[model samples]
Target: MAATTAVQTKKKKDRTFVTTMKRLLKNKLAIFGLIIILLQVVMAIAAPVITIHSPFKQNLAQSELPLFSEGHFLGTDNFGRDLWSRIVYGARISLLVGITAVGLGLAGGVTLGLIAGYYRRLDGIIMRIVDLLFAFPGILLAMLIIAVLGTSLVNVAIAISIWSIPTCARIVRGSVLSVKKQEYVQAMKSLGASDFRILVKHILPNCSAPIIVFATMRMATAILSTASLSYLGLGAQPPTPEWGAMISQGQDFMWTSPHMTIVPGIAIMLIVFAFNVVGDGLRDALDPNMNLNQ
Candidate 1:
């Protein structure tokens, strides 16, 4: 009997997974976004083999070459650095900063969020701290953190993560508040389950959808913030092949070498747009009320 029950439970879980996947697949925008993300990831990973020229290599004599100029398909920057190569390589830093910072923020934010939502006594204090962080603009907060921590790729990632943490915490706390009152959670409480068990086993699982959606959306935000900081000389430094820094360097020569500005700017926009649409699709798919299937 117990074996039959276990088998049935497994089947049910598998069915639920299948259903969720089906829903996601039905979302055209989500599929489009997924493709964009996958392409960027591939581009980032295969940067060296695919890049036309060494992103850091200088060719002062060939500087500001126009687009579609023989070997330089995307042209060269003001420093004669290959714009195509830099853009391709720049994907690495942008995606890395986005994914790493979001992952870090998820960790700290999940902990604080779970604690604040589950523990009444700590909720106010934690949320107040979150509020304080939010009072400053998100990018401003990131810049402030970068200013204090000084600049580098890792420090930039840390700064972005710190900025992201409060947002994550607030999203999770709201989701948790709704989840904790669910029937199973109350049943767990009534059956003498510890708060930790109820939270970890019941509450958090139910909150996963919103957390996932929020995380996806925040990745784009983090990327933009990282790029902005890099542009402002507070993130990746010179010759780093970072998109924002590339834009910063290109801005001065925008008239003669517009490709320098346009290429990187387009890259950032495509990434952010992809993630935003994916987040929207996920939100729609996850919400039972919104039918993705026509």
Candidate 2:
């Protein structure tokens, strides 16, 4: 009976923590961004059902039509591809690239950062390499990488991941440094806990909040970087409904059909904005000193 009561009490405490988190995340800007991001996800998932025309199917007669034409609502592009369909499908490309690149960076950076932070002797060598990568602007670094790897979806993802690694590693190192000084971590060290056990069981868990917030922010940056690469003809090759590729295709006809460029541009802006808002919200919500009821 005592064990059951204790288990229930622990569960209640966890639920309280989750509820407090939800209350903090109710910030208007954050909620609005979450809604917009959710809508885009749904639109991407329902692309086929949402659009009447195929994203790649062309109709020369309907080419360059304006928004709200007789049949097309968002109109057609230079190749007579449906603007709405292309935009809907393009969400998939942006989201996939953002998530995949950030996931790769998070995996590699966190491992390296934890090791470098826990081992002082390794810090200098690891950080110097990070600094070297950081010397160039992220977009330029990605461009150079893509140029070497040759343009392709996989190559673009790899480039973005590489560019993202240094930032993630730096953020994780900062978090780990703060966590290592906590009394609990020191107490574990005094008890003769193995370095690996202390780090994995004590330090890393405490430092996860900042790492999560940074990852969310990095996702937005990754998306923009991938788009830039695609714009330069290094990602999501022709006939693919990538937002950046769509923008590149529409650039030549910017005067005649501004919607082609503007629509995709808007999509990219909204997605990046959504991620930034969510990241900011998470940072605030995860702060232990923050009082939601106040």
On lDDT, the candidate that comes out on top is 1
List TM-score per model, in order: 0.93, 0.91
lDDT (Cα atoms) of all candidates against the true structure? 0.88, 0.86
Give me candidate 2's TM-score against the actual structure.
0.91
lDDT of 1 by residue, 89-158 (tens): 8999999889999999999999899999988899999999999988999788888888888999898889
Pull out the clashing pairs in model 2: none
Cα lDDT tens digits for candidate 2, 1-294:
979967996897587569657865678898888888899889988888988889889999789999998778998997788888888989988888888999998888888789888888999999999999999998888889888989898888888898888888898888888789888788879989999999787788777888888888988898888788888898999899998988998999999999989999999999999999988988888776674454
Candidate 1 local accuracy as lDDT? Answer: 0.88
